[model samples]
Target: MRAKVTVMLKNGVLDPQGEAVKSALGALGFAGVDAVRQGKVIELDLAETDAAAAEATVRDMCEKLLANTVIESYGVEIL
Candidate 1:
């Protein structure tokens, strides 16, 4: 099974990297962009065959280590 996890900062959290990227985009003449948020994607291959089980496993990984649940939120997809 394959799973994908997306980890992103929760709203109201400070995102310095996102800010820097936004500034750079404006400097490069992309003025239409009003905001930017940065996040991470993790793809995993698992031995588990069931979609439900794979998704649950990935979500556990995110809660335990992949994401800092206090300041970040994560989504899991089974593929």
Candidate 2:
């Protein structure tokens, strides 16, 4: 099984890195840009064959270690 996790900052949290990128884009002549938010994608190859089990495992991983859970939120997908 393959699992994918996307981790992103929750709404209202400060995102300095995202702001920096947006500013840089404006400087590079992409001034029409309004905002930017940065996030991470993690792809995993799992030995588990059951889709339900794999999704549960990945969700657990996100809650335990992949995402902070306070300032960040995560989503898991099975492929």
Can you give the TM-score per candidate against the true fold? 0.97, 0.97
Candidate 2 lDDT tens digits, 25-57: 988899689889999999999999999999999
lDDT per residue (tens digit) for residues 1-79 in model 1: 9898999999999999999999999999887898999999999999999998888889889989999999999999888
Backbone clashes in model 2, listed as residue pairs: none
Model 2, position 78: C-alpha lDDT score: 95
Residue pairs in clash, model 1: none
